[model samples]
Target: MGWVSRLSTVIRTQVNDWVGAVEDPEVRLDQAIADLQMELLQLRQSVAQAIATQKRTERQRGQHQTWAVEWYNRAHLALVKGEEALAREALSQRQSYLTLMAKMDDYLGQQRQVVEQLKGTMRTLEQQIAEARTRRDLFKARARSAEASQRLHTLMAEVGDRVTGGVFDSMEDRVLDLEAQAAALTELSQMQPTVSLTSQDSRETTASVEAELTVMKTRLGQG
Candidate 1:
């Protein structure tokens, strides 16, 4: 039972390794890069919203400052007319603007901090996205190079097998056959028989055959 459990574990490990090999790293890198880009896009939107808040704060501050200036003018006029209560009322109005100024100033300051932080975050995310893109390009190039090298190695292996299986030997044999035929043709071309066999020559050839037959009979007589 222990051995069976160990065998199953080994089999599962091998299957996982095979599956990992089948998965392309280039695709994974691209997906990761895409995810980063999406995050960067969201960050950019956040930065834009932060900037809008900053602008709105600046506009509100400007409007408040104008009211403050107008209220100051009213208080100055009331003092010039010698209306002490009117002067006090005008001063009270200015005090309200002062209180609002303090609050808006603090709120605007916080908003400024937020906007700056968001901008910094956007910058950092942009840099990371750029680095990721560069890494993705480098990895893809390296993968392509590795793939090409693997194909070349595979082709070399096939050639080695063909050489081992005697395909070249067959080609060598064919070349030898062609050379032999060529040599035979050359020999035939060189052979220029000057004399033709006449009827008398044929009779002499027949006599030569008969002489050989008599010699063969004499030699075989001991048997």
Candidate 2:
């Protein structure tokens, strides 16, 4: 029995410790949602930058293509003017622009992919944020309800303790004392009549005895 009691005490202590160590769900959930929101915000910024870079790359690619076309036209004009060396130089410049344009095209393709990936990630993060918000709201409501219930239970327990503790015991003692006093008063009242009757009987007996003594004296002529 003693070991059982010790085990029970240990269990209770451990349970209390666990309860104390547990974080408040409402606070934890709020923090978690805040962190998620921060992550989403940062991701959105990254996505926006990625999109801007993609647009810039596209613009650069377009400019290179335009330059390539201009160089080709110049090359054609130089050939018509019978300037072979100049035409060759213009063709070389056009080839350089075309190479740059090809490189830009490759880079743009990769950039588009990166932008799409970022957009997709943003969408997923947004969904996660939405889910977190919903869960936070739900958990907060549950926490509030649990706290309210706990408060009510505590109040009821306090009331129960008051009713069953020293206050209640003292009231019981007071009632017992009142009853005892009433009983004593009743006993005293009952004894008063008996005392009065005994006194009257003693006086009557004394008077009767004195009268008999006088009669006896008168009968013996000694009065």
Candidate 3:
């Protein structure tokens, strides 16, 4: 009895400890989910920023191309008017615009590359977020299961104590009664009528009556 009581106490203590650990794991899982969500938000912002930068670079490239064309046209008109020095200066201005256009094109290309890279990164981050969410749910479910298992263990330990205290004596009596009833059923099945020579031989005897008298004597002794 002492060993049984000690074992039950140990089980209860272990269950309490495990329940606390399970609760901690659930909390950590939630924190991890929140952290992943924050990371996803940051990735989205980065993707948005990359897109904005790409758009700005594209607009700058277009504006520079237009300016370069306008400069070239002006330079050609001045040359056709025979203003040599003015045409020369206008051509120089046109060359400057062309240089600016080339630089803008290079920058636009870089911006486009950055945007594509950012988009890829965003996709990867989204995938990670999805995986994290799945893991969070799995972890949470495991935590809940662990907690329930711990609770059940604690309950079993308590119930085991109650059984020792005789609090469940009636339940024990009921269970014994059920067992006796099952035994009676088995006895009745053995006594079932059968088309056999041995059964016919016992049918006219007092075998069943003797079996009932024996069971009654045993029951009286036990009481």
TM-score of each: 0.74, 0.62, 0.67
Task: List the lowest-lDDT window of 10 residues for candidate 1.
Answer: 1-10
- Candidate structures ordered by TM-score, highest first: 1, 3, 2
Q: What pairs collide in candidate 2?
A: none
**In each prediction, how many residue pairs overlap at the backbone (N, C-alpha, C within less than 3 A)?**
0, 0, 0
Per-model lDDT: 0.78, 0.81, 0.79
lDDT head-to-head 1 vs 2, winner: 2
Question: lDDT tens string, model 3, 1-223?
Answer: 4566677778778877877887786788778778877887887888788788778777776777787788778878988998888888877887887788788778878878887887787788778778877887887788778778877776776677767776678888999999999999998777665546566677656778877888998999952
Candidate 2 accuracy as TM-score: 0.62
CA shift of 46, model 2, Å: 1.6
The CA lDDT at 118 in model 3 is: 76
Q: Counting only residues 3 or more apart in sequence or on different chains, how many pairs clash (N, Cα, C under 3 Å) in candidate 2?
A: 0
Compute the lDDT of residue 178 as modeled in candidate 2.
100
What TM-score does prediction 3 earn? Answer: 0.67
Candidates 2 and 3, the one with greater lDDT: 2
Candidate 1 lDDT: 0.78
